[model samples]
Target: MHDVVIAGGGPVGLFLAGELALSGCSVLILERDRDLTSPLKALPFGMRGLNAGSAETFHRRGLLEAMLEASGADRKEVGADPDASEAPAPRDVSHFAGMGLDAGGIDASALPFRLPGPAMAGFMTSLEAVSTVLTRWAASLGVEIVRGAPVTAVTQDAGGVTATAGGQEHRGRWLVGCDGGRSAVRELVGFDFVGTDPLFTGYVAKVTFADPRQLPLGFNLTPTGMYLRTSFEGHLGMNDFDGGTFDRSQPLTREHLQAVLRRISGTDVTLTDVELASSFTDRAMQATRYRKGRVLLAGDAAHIHSPLGGQGLNLGIGDAVNLGWKLAATVHGTAPEGLLDTYTDERHPIGAAVLDWSRAQVATMKPGPNAPALRKLVLDLLSTPGGVTHVYRQTSGLFHRYDLGGEQPLIGLSAPDFRFQEGARLGELLRQGRGVLLDFGRDRALQTAAEGWAGRIHYAAGPVRNDLGFTALLIRPDGIVAWADDHADTEAFQRAATRWLGHPRTWAPQVGSGRVE
Candidate 1:
């Protein structure tokens, strides 16, 4: 039996597959679509933004640079030079609702905990570029991809999961549904998807306009609806708050799109041709639980929200990263009891927060008397340091912290990318997909204690210029700080190690003293 059978071959599934295979787990990806290329995943329609956490995840796996390079985005554009004397050049800033925040107003200095490094907090790329890079990477790691085979049914018991696709049956120890919002696996597994419904039907299309100047240059919020025009020729987006009226199953036509555009833009904008068109809604829903029995769900299968802030992709990718390692460990027979449950506990709240964030944007963008005041207040607030910082932190995914419960302040947070005295950075060490026991004191006893878990954890001793308030840190494979202490104690270190790595078969010396029995 395969170690994992993933439904859907999108970026999230491919990423999870690569992670599992990196740790020597067999993965098989079942994709519905045979052709990976599509116009909608190309220019303006395919554009997506990667938040801080997603970018860092890619960097930890040594794939960020390659993905960016393939997308034609300059490395310098994503991050600033640490040694630069002058202010770093500004890139495109993120928006909440339809109002954009000023890039210059953001004060990065306020975020002292954020490390200075080459990794970016946010960057824009197309879906095609992301899928191309991840597909290649996953394939290189020995992940098997079977396209044109959609998962029609799924059955699971304590033993394993069985998925039926294209008249064939596949069995695996675990199953993860990474399919899009409308997941067949989730439906077959009978997961409870509970949340609010859609408020509007949104449209994104690539059209050949007879007269483009009739529309506004950038995003235009009208009394009736909203519309956006990008730098790409004839790429347009329109939002019609018709209480979710338009039929999504029906194919979109040029006539229908032109009518919608003219009505929303309040212009005589004529469309000559529609090269590509698609529809989405504000319907937000999340599975009550991420896992049931031997079956699990990730990406859109677990939770889905409006694409207002472009957070859907980022959130789904986060779920894959968080679940991949724990699930792999479980299959490898090394996970502590209840370790798999932590995925739902940690990521559920994050998903709920994103849903609320999108809902808030929709509320503020509604065309009504109250919306004007709300928008004005939000814009005014975004202009200030406090306002800008809050919005930046929320949208950038930098504020994410797990509830790993520990005395140290950095516990449950992403480990700071500290530069070691020996010239290796924390991100560099994480590339191998192993937990790290970072020690700045060069405690020989600590190294000895970690030897029992030898291949599973790496022991490194190096001094950092800025320790970020901690002398040592125990980082997980996913780059989260499971344990941290201001001052090293033998007992404390032992407890932390046992909590994450499981109790060593044979105990070693104390953290700072002589060997023990």
Candidate 2:
């Protein structure tokens, strides 16, 4: 039997498969669509923002560089020296409910926990590019991906899971549903998907306009609805607040899109051709539990929300990364008691928060007098320093912290990308997909404590340029801090290691003079 049978070969499934395979677990991905390439996943419609968490996850896996290189995103133009005769480079900007905030207003210094690095807080990318990169990487790691195989049913007991897909049966020690929001595995598993419905139907399309000048350029917020026209040829988006009257089940037509454009933009814009069109709603939902017996849910199958702020893709990727290592450990028979359960405990709240974030955006964008006033208030707040920083931190996924029940603030937060004196970067250390016990002081006791978990945990001793108020940190496979302290506490360190990496399988004595065992 395979270690994991994942439903859906999208980015999330492929990412999780790569993670599992990196840890030497067998993974099989069953995708419903035979053709992976679709216009919906291309530019304009397919554009997705990669937040800090998602970007860092890729960096740790050594995939971010490849993706950036492939997309020609690595060759960024260097800013001209202001002291010289050249103009400074343009600053990067982020948005809140379509309200833009420049890099100047955001005070990165206020974020004391963020590590100094060249890694971006956020960047624009397309779903097609991300999926393409992940598919290749997963395959390289020996993951088997089967397309045109839709999962119809799933049966699970304490021993394993059996999935029926494309008139064939597949068995695995565990099953994960990474399918889209309309997840068949979720339905068959009887998961309690609970949440609010949509307030409007959103449309994204690429079309040729009969009279392009009739529509205004950029975003237009009207009394009835909102619309956006991009610089790209015939790329437009509209939000029709008709209590989601548009039928998403049917294929989108040119006539329907023209109607939506006219109503939302309040313009007599005629569409000559609709090259591509897709509709989405702000309907938010989340599975009550991420796991049921030997079956699990990740990505869109676990939670779904409006694409506002482009948080959906990042949230799904975070779920995959967080669940990957824990699930692999469970399947490898190296997990501690309750290790797998922590996946839901840590990720469920994040999903709920994203849903609420989406709801807040939709509420402000609703067509009403009150919504306009609220939008004005929000815009005013975003113009301020505190508001800009807070929103940036939240939307960029930099402020996400799991409640690991530790007094230390660093605990349960993403580890800063520390630059050590030995020229090793923290992100580089994580490329091996193993937990790390980073000791800045190079304490012998800490090294000795980590000796038993050598293979599962990598112990490193180095002096970092910036300590970020922590002398030591125990970073999990996903780069989350399971424990941190200003000073080394051997007993506490051992306890945290046991809790996260599990009790040492074999104890080994420290070798002479060498720091690590």
Candidate 3:
């Protein structure tokens, strides 16, 4: 038996394994892929997730530096560097001159912190980056990784959960399914995966750029009702994703490639090296049930959708960070198991929202007389300052906020990714396998309360980010402000903390785990 056994070693499962391992939980990951040690092999421009908030995850876990080292990517290096002399961000689409995506709101500059391990997300990088870094780092912290063992089913009771993997059974105090769209673990637990499936099949092919003039060095063709798109980078800095809907009966062939190049680039530039091409459909579904007995679902198992916003991959990984620590806290008997319930309560709605928006985008992309007009409206909004701000916030994942009620105003807001003058940035401290109290550099009572109960709760202080304002706050492991104190009201702050995390802040029974369950 293990403390936690995760099915599906995709981005979500890999991240969960790392979080659990880092939290000191004895965890094992069962991946169906043949190679256990291979880095995540992804297509050139596979947009992962689009949360500006994801930056917190990448920076906190030190994966930013990991990717920089692995792919030799410079943080300052972007497709559109105003100062680049030779290769530059793409400038135009077919008949659309200088058609470049304005990614001005994003902070492409590198911050401080050298990370103790490796980084994961980036185009031209591997999917295994997230898993490999977590696996190795988690193993160093004593987590185990098992590959090629696809989970066949799961059985659970109040005591624990047992999983059958490729004719073998593994028991654990709790089971987490990070498996992709079709989750065996979810099916075994009797959870209903109710959501929309793709009516059209899509293919993604990563072609090497031997010819520089094929397409401009920028984002997916400004989303103009033009031909298809070129390479688009996810806000997370993963792979470049480019490709579109394909006929279900027809396979992706050179003809399709020719047609795409002809429509967008106005050049019939043939490619010799097609590194990787994957054909899959969209599924905008979420499990009707997130937890059944001791078995729980996360990532793709919990939600799957059209990869329009680069959300599928990143959303799953985000679920890992959110659920892993909650489950570990529950198993350790610190917080109430109720905390785990929050995973579904919080993320399920987010999934639904993404599905709705993604479907709208796919609808807009439909080739028809109105398609051009629809695309024009979107681009017009995107060009405006308000539209640009909203677009970046929505697409970059920075605007993701939860309704988790806490006295701290920042509770639902993205945790302040402030620059730490003396120590590591506030974000880096969170990746230390524990929750961080933003402290906002105020309130002695929190220290007293935390000291009153040592080991279980931890605290750290940093000045608020210039954008966050002048107040002390406490952030959770998932980079959400669990509690914040605007003034020097220690008792009020402690009360808020108690309501948010449950004092002694454990997964104990009876007091509710901050969820409807």
The number of the candidate with the highest lDDT is 2
C-alpha lDDT of residue 334 in model 1: 78
Candidate 3 per-residue lDDT, tens place, 433-506, comes to 56666566655766776654344445665553342444556567677766665554667656655654567643
Clashing pairs in 1: none
For model 1, what is the alpha-carbon lDDT of residue 229?
Answer: 91
Query: All models: lDDT?
Result: 0.81, 0.82, 0.59
- Superposed Cα deviation of residue 312, candidate 3 (Å): 1.8
Q: Which ranges in model 3 have alpha carbons more than 4 Å from their true place? A: 37-51, 77-100, 104-125, 206-276, 406-408, 419-421, 440-443, 461-471, 505-517
Which pairs in model 2 have colliding backbones? none
Candidate 3 residue 163 C-alpha distance from true site, Å = 1.0
lDDT of 3: 0.59
Residue by residue across 406-511, what tens digits does model 1's lDDT show? 7666788787777776667788777767788898888777788778777677788878756777777789988998888776665777787777767665322111
Candidate 1 deviant stretches above 4 angstroms: 82-93, 505-517
CA-only RMSD, every prediction? 5.2, 4.9, 7.9
lDDT of 2 by residue, 197-241 (tens): 888888888999999998877777788888888888899888888
Per candidate, the number of residue pairs that clash is 0, 0, 43
* lDDT winner, 1 or 2: 2
